[model samples]
Target: MPKLQGFEFWKTTLQEARYVVAPMVDQSELAWRLLCRRHGAQLCYTPMFHAQVFVRDANYRRENLYAEVCPEDRPLITQFCANDPEVFVQAGLLAQDHCDAIDLNLGCPQMIAKRGHYGVFLQDEWELLEKMVKLAHEKLSVPVTCKIRVFQDVERTVRFAQMLEKAGCQLLTVHGRTKDQKGAFTGMADWEHIKAVRKAVSIPVFANGNIHHLTDVEQCIQETGVHGVMSAEGNLHNPALFEGSSPPVWEMAEEYLEVVQQHPPCTLSFVRAHLFKLWHHTLQIHQDLREELAKVKSLEGLSEVSRQLRLRCQEEIAKEKEGAEERPRGDLPFPHWMCQPYVRPPPKVLVPNGQSQGSEETKTESHKRALEDSDGTPDSLSKNKQKKKARNPHKTFCLELKPKYMKCEQCGNPKGSKCVFDLCRACCKKKAYKEVADCPSHGLRFKTKADRQRVEEERAGAIGDQEPPDGSQGLPETHNTEQEVH
Candidate 1:
């Protein structure tokens, strides 16, 4: 195994901080970090940042990079996602002053990551990964680290761990799941593989995944002999896991709310997610309350929900003390809240006819023209023609037998290409794509109210400002009409 610089520094750091908070994309922000620290998380990592965006857009850095650490928040690591070594160096330089270490996000298995040529998709590019790490190690003042998922083969996974260390990764975090084993199939993390990697590498290794409870931390350390254990969903559900069995959801949620209120404000969506995770158990038994919580869009709204849950918890504990029966737990087969598969909307229904009443291509063109025209008016004649063209509604809709398991649904990879992350062959042709761009514009990708508002204003402004090309009455003929596969 290649020896990395600053291993000694991390060795001491890990010795003192055996319980870590994984760098979750939106979940591990300042408020969550502070909560984890209060519950005995020795070290914390910020949400992953895009190196290209961090270096190019000052506005993005200002909006997205919101660590807001204090003296007590030491031993924090800032993770960056990057495909280019130079961009990684630039991003690291900007972040080194605030964080104890710089971590490379090598484990993200989302299709967006693969399309952008970063995260797990870059796993095959050994030399490039090495060079990026080496550049950060040599150029940055702080130590460099990497968080990676294991491969299908244990030998390759072990070699990958060692290669990261050899390339100047002072600390390594190993997530036990393979890149393809996400969502419903996330199953148990392979501790045996983690043990093999820990044995092969001299640097500190942090084991992530399957850390459902506090006891699981000790069990993982005993089995894998890793320097530390990190948790994302588990911690979100019970930020107090590093300490012991969680108190009530209300207690933790209330504490987090207070902490965030004292610091700079966080996005309402983030606050909602944390509160929902903390209350997953309570909500499972209270379907009506869950609907109200789901609609929460402000910290004030969250506080109101927290107030109710806190009172409910208190009431339940009092009832138990008075000999009242305890409420039954959720009957869901999945033990932990994280085990549930991410919910996806039902697929779009095809037009009733076997073929589209009007060609989809023609409709796309008509829509483009509607947007370009000064009046932005719908053509009444075209609508009438389409309505007249409609034939038997019963014959229009088509259904095909859906596969129980699909390797890639986005670009529709062949059955043999069992890669997950929702990637398809179509995306493989693209040179670059933004991972988070495909998400709903109003989702958690925006960190704060101001961030989302700014985006909305910009989007509206751009649309209104657009002008037709010289000598042309409509948008460019080459305007892309096909939807993003993912």
Candidate 2:
């Protein structure tokens, strides 16, 4: 709760005051705010709006400040423009239930500001701004705060701070650039100027401008000696910047896919742009040549590119498995799985005695004969392919007929080992089979009785005094913990 200093809540403090986020209209919508909140932004402000409009138009509020926020988005501010003290106060009071504080925007510098008689145009009108602050303090129960630009002259800016302080505004946020410095090159934010304001004002001061990364937060704190830092464009590019992470790929990639699903399919251009930033770091350590990665242009393309790169990267990671020493790639022999089997079983073998003497040499001779008798050109792959012209007598000896015991549907490998309930190990591993352990979930694999038993044991064990590890807990009702009295 903010301490009641007349109308201003003097004691109310921000939770993550060390790093604050500056608001940008259109780009900084509710979706963006939620993203930032999830990514570690401590404090946030909505884009500056006309207080009069925020109070009057339902559609405007719905489109702008009306966010269906989660509980975690608390301790946030929504900024509004008001040349009139009453307008400012009413807007502030109305915004109290939804936002933590209402920031009075006296710093916006666009042509609209001049036309609306708000923002930078009102910088010269100190008394009106002061009065707006006064009414904001007197009328609104929330903390009264202001966001401003570094003045045209340092002395004049100091005077502006003094005037706002006299109006009962308890906190001031200074964007270190001046009115002339619109867009990127207006000027670098002067930590010196922000420090100057901090020295002059008794209120909490947050230094804004050029805070894009976690390191910037520290540097800004060192330079300005203000209460904290606020960033606008910087937050847009890397939302997790405050926490010192480069960015999270897996979670955000999943979110981007969700956005694509709900908000209509995004253009390939957008996905490529987003993923480019994400995979730029991935590219730094990837073994694939940069030229190979450069060809990617869409989600699918990037997916393929990222897969190829990460697959190779996985091999590198596997090399680093504990106790395993790295070996030269050239020195390693190609795996045995890569080679083609030279022998193929044939139903009959002709010996000089006109009888059967089946051996590897005869099998090799039969394999060559079968391939030679094949319809098309015999390729290197023919040696490994099953000899279609002949069948082996041993197959009947080995294969357990299907539809009884679970049997291999394709190439037979040990008939007794049923892919119970006819499901292959691969499929069972994925579908997490129970009753239908023999069947494949989709098509590629099958579940087993072992899988079902393990699942039942786990399901039974999970009840009562147990908590599942994260989301690995199976369905509650399906996993009946109790057995029959029998």
Candidate 3:
């Protein structure tokens, strides 16, 4: 096959970018991108920016495209969501100097995209989509690529990939979900369809969806025959997904915080999203701590909350070692917190002739075996057991009392709740309350005696006569419900 447009440059990049960090809205900021690159991500996309916003709003360009692009951040793709060919070309030309390639985001399924008439909403306008890509190919100095959602009709999906290639897209990212498969309807990504798309196009294809672990990267490539794999939620939860080791969530959190601090001036909202994702699985179980972390505004406040959570996680691990039931190592993968988690069947490695090689043990199982092989006991298990047995009396007492310190004086519930793990009746009845319960600082609180009085005074001043307010809204809850698109 003759090369797709710009294949000369894209092919060189594909050789090293087998594992990519997907472009995410509000989440894929520079700080997080740098963090993912440190772990093993070879290619990273900036969050999907509206081309119109990038073109018209000087401040948006300065803020969103403001990251200090270092040599280590090479082969970056700046993705834009646009439906107009002329405006999009203008956006691409502006961005081409900063990135290796400019990507058209054709796969976002958010309601915002439908309202804006971009993303997957443009899928049916094949002629317009091609013109947009062709315009960028002709106008920009760098290569043009697109990330698109699949169609319900397999034939149409294949045809769409072929059209993009013919229209001068040098690289293609195929998200396995259709435009309608969003939010609660986002079922598993159909890799079989992705394989079909790969067969129909000459351009380098990257698969997205059902990728939540490091091993999933290799599995997606082997199963779909795509040149690369892309991750969003998986990398957000474990920025170390490409590193092939399941380090504890706090360790990952600490590493991310260090990178974020070094890259100063990161938006408070962006920093909060990364923090919640890194601790989502464990923190969900402790609503009190989750709520406290949400209210943090500065890096210092975030750092203190993270430190407290790390200590809490250590305590949980110790309790499990002493009396908790044997459970899977590491908290369940982030997807498990949603409905029943998708347990991927082992991927079949294929030989050159396309025959199935054989099924192999999953990465999780292999890791377990490796641990068991080391001195006949998993190192993590052995180490925890040794710590449980050998910890000094004073340290153990402090760890045990930490939770008590976080409890309220009057209600006896923690800072995240009014009742015991539930809200008190009066507070719950308030019309001002969003479903998330208040900590009810009135007449009760955590930490020092002075802390309780201070909270009580703040509540009195704020309440006066009107209903007490729910704290000023923090970062909105991130609903990364889709696999392929934003």
Candidate 4:
């Protein structure tokens, strides 16, 4: 049968989904997708799989997409990150049978994505992206789609979307942030860029980012004129965000755990991460349970910890009802026990006087600063580096505080302090082999070879000094003895 494309594919195969759960790395597993689907999610994407790995590794394919014959996970899209056109097509072919469409990931901005030379790193290479999408569209039975981060310039972003559409991309998901807008700098997504891309493309467009609630989804569609709205971090915190209800954290947590139970062999780490996001606000109030959640190893253990947390929250709720406690909601619109969006605090900016502008500093930042003050290291050092220095005070990372390293005479590399040849390990090995010498400091042993040679020489000399078996010192003496006997 001929494959569907563009609006026909969107309307028929996808049912014109408007509320989409974005493709998260480890978080959007089969169990989580099913849970979100039950809570009114119109569509979902499988976690982004490495194209090369997915093509070669059968276990990866089974564990991710073909874990079971899940009929409920319909109208799904399997996404992949790839830089090669052929490999991307191969992966798409492998995944196309299972999903309604195959999505090329051009939205990831993590350091891993950068190192792998895929994802947003390939955004500037328009030719490669075009070839990859076009090849997949030509080869696979399913429609080809792309999820991309916007360029800083709106015109360029719109042109990029248009190019994808021309290259056989049936659908496009435009995350309204540049590649650089990630981590702590993930300020706010620009709806203007998404709106522009929606205008430029003839295919179905999905607007991603800045969606924390169902209201945001409605507002985004109304503003951007896109067919759909996708959410990642917001969905993680509140799975029912699309349902237009902020359910209790325990309710979501327990339901997710139940869904996880149905999907056997679901990764414990993924389940743990989901629980952490669900109980993020509550964990702030009950820090002890947070530790327990992190330390849990099994699913039952996670459920038990969740149950304990539920009891604690119920007790707090009882107190609030009786007017015995006046718990402050702080910045949260609802109480901490309810599921809501986790608003990322803005990045702290440093003033000219070396003080941060924001009075509210994270615990990690404060710990890092305190460590720096005591260790005499610059505050510019990373938090991890500061923590490492605090753990091992004697270890010096500063070049000024480090002991002088002696250079090898033969090579410029650093030499062992106790090396007899005064050379690096490589140079020392060569010199030792040539001179029949031993360098114990460098673990290079040449003495055994020399000893074997000496033994062979001594054996040869001893054989030459030995008398004949007939007791004849010379040939003349042997001849005279024979004549006297005659």
Candidate 5:
């Protein structure tokens, strides 16, 4: 069965569209999504929600689920998951009235999901997933869609997509990682797998995962050849990465700055979070630049820093232009960070399906800490390193570390120059690994492994605080039973 509004939904979705940012829970909140919408995000999804609580808790409705939605934020979808058709149908009926469409979460791969029986676990039971889809389509007038990941085996993924199509899901998004890889070791998103899903169904298909720039979008299209492309970390890096066509780098950054500045009362924490991701993920090379910019704490500070950085970017662009004018070279030599090998994170082997994604508060805190400190590398580069840059064709040069910040390499000194590798000596002695994993999207390595640990801890705690599903209960202790949304 085709979606009742299938034509309208998909038609308007990518009419002048080049991208749809992936629905990452913490990263894809209304504020970030709106920033993207202003840029080039033609369509996007609210972070996933459990249908049970959406119906049971008014607080969940007002606060977590529908917090930043406004009229301008049209063409948005609220994704929901449920075990019982009746429950989700009730929730979808309500959600469809508010959102342009509603989606089912059939692709989450966390442990909480398996135990809670949602997300990627649904792939295990085709019959149940099909029923959930049919019920949602039958119960709601707005378009019904689902997001999925390619199973480890390609044919299984194809069969699953067919089932979803049969159940009347009008549009589908396929993230390339399977339930098995769990986003570990840079799960190379299998674009070919997404193409297979596209081939299996007639509905518009969007490709997702690891896209960081407009160039990446073009690469994915050239590779997958899908109807549309979606990115979480990519859009997070450059809000204006998507338009009817590829956007210029500085233009994307300028548009984002404009959007953030329009909201004066917004917190420094919020502003920094977006800026940090934009620089680290979207642009490559220049770690000194990335680390320095990562610390600006105020609006004025952002402006001053922007003045200096914009000059640097302009100079680099000019250098490249001159090179092209003189010869056939197109751009400046690519910087160190992108070409250099980077860090890693513990594999998210088992996502607890019931785990909460994260909160604005959590996002704010992570941003605050990431910036508010001096990390590793010397305050000044040694003469030898400078000479090497002037001489070597390809060399891996380390940034100098200020003694104050480079106290040790285990626990990074927050007060010191982005002191990294947990150089706190204390952390070095207690180090789980030699280095810290950088941002998956940005490739900006952490000053210390401790920061990485903190990210994981906070995410776990945030999951604990998740507003529980009705009967698929979650952390009772973490729940703010006293603090209801409404």
Candidate 6:
């Protein structure tokens, strides 16, 4: 059968999914996808796979997609991050049969993505992106899609979307934030940019960002006029976000565990992370349980911790019913036991005068300010650094206080302290190679002529020492006969 494209693929293959679970690293796995599907997520994306690794490593393929195939987790898209057009197409081809579509991840903004030269870092290279998407579209059995971060300018974003659409992108998921807007700087996403892209592109569009609840999902779809809304952090905290319900923490945790059991070999770390997000609020109130959750290694151990937390929450509920105790609701819209979205505090700006002048600063920023005010005093060091210095007072980070390095005898560069030849690494390497000697300290090895000759002599001696195969401790019978004939 011929593969569908554009709105046809979105409607026929994806069932026109309106609520999507965003592709998250190490968070969205088969079990989690199944749990979200049960709770009303219409579409899901696999965690972003490194395209080169996905192509090269069989273990990665099995662990991620092949090991367990759940029929319930349908309308799935496998996302890959790659800069090379051929490699991107190769990965998509490998994954195409398993999913409804293959999504090129052009939205990741982490440091890892920057170092790899893939993800949003490649957004400027429109030619490369076009080649990748076009090649995938030509080669894959399923449709090729792209998930991208918007450029700062809405017009540029619209142009980018149009470029991808022309290059044969069947669907596009626009994360409504610039590549720079990540981590502490992840402010509100600009729906206007997403709206512009949706207007410009002919393919089906999905908007991601600023989605915390079902209401936000509805609002995003209405404001941007996109076909769908994708949620990452919000979904992690509350899987039922699309269902417009905030269930209890234990309810989600237990259901997820049940799904994990049904879908054997779910990663322990993935399960632990999901539990941590689900129990985020309750853990804040019960710090002890939070520590237990972090320390626990086994699946049963994690389930046990969840059960203990449920008991504690039930006790709190009993107290509230009797009017015996009233807990303070600080910033939570719901009780700590219930699942809710975690709101990231805005990024803080550090001023030149050692005072935070912008939004509220994080603890690390406050510590930095304290250090700046102290003017290089030892007391200004962080607690951990101070403790380390206490153990060795000679140790210091101040450049002026550091001991001067000894120069090499042959070169002016810093020498290896234990060098037998008293030289820098390069100088030592040259001398070692010339002399056919080994310098253990500098990790240079060279076999001397004498050493080589000695090894050859040892090998010859061993050959001569070997007795006949008949077990006599003498020369071979043929050699003895030849000697007698002589």
Best by lDDT: 4
Instruction: Give the runs in model 4 whose Cα sits over 4 Å from its true position.
Output: 347-486
Report the C-alpha lDDT of model 5 over 359-476, residue by residue, as the tens digit: 2221101111222122322324355554555576344433344223434433345322342343343443334244444432222445446777889999998887784656456456
Off by over 4 Å in 3: 1-7, 321-486
Question: Alpha-carbon error at 8 in model 4, in Å?
Answer: 0.6
Per-candidate TM-score against the hidden true structure:
0.67, 0.53, 0.67, 0.77, 0.57, 0.79
Off by over 4 Å in 5: 1-8, 12-18, 64-67, 243-272, 281-486
Taking the tens digit of each residue's C-alpha lDDT, what string does model 4 give over 331-363?
999999999999987646533543577454332
The CA lDDT of each predicted structure is 0.75, 0.63, 0.75, 0.89, 0.66, 0.88
How does residue 461 of candidate 2 score in lDDT? 79
TM-score order, best first, reads 6, 4, 1, 3, 5, 2
For model 5, where is the 10-residue window of minimal lDDT? Answer: 360-369
Off by over 4 Å in 2: 1-13, 248-486
Clashing residue pair totals per candidate (backbone < 3 A): 4, 11, 0, 0, 46, 0
lDDT of 1 by residue, 85-177 (tens): 999999999888877788999999998898888899889899999999988888988889999999999999999988888988988999999
Against the true structure, candidate 3 reaches a TM-score of 0.67
Candidate 1's TM-score: 0.67
Clashes of 5: 46
Query: Total clashes, candidate 1?
Result: 4
**What's model 5's lDDT at 299?**
78
User: What is the Å distance of residue 478 in model 3 from its true position?
Assistant: 78
Query: Over the full model, what C-alpha lDDT does candidate 4 score relative to the true structure?
Result: 0.89
The residue-by-residue lDDT of candidate 2 on 1-486, one tens digit each, is 444541234334465366677767544445455566666777778777788997788877665665434465666788888788887787777677778777888888888887898887788888788778887777776778888888757888898988988888777889888887764334457777788888898888888887756788898888778877887756654666676765334345445545544443344544554444444444544535344545566566656664565466557557668547764433213221111111112435444544467333331122233333323322422433423212432222112332454534443432334333344454444444444434433343234567777898888876733755575555666665465333
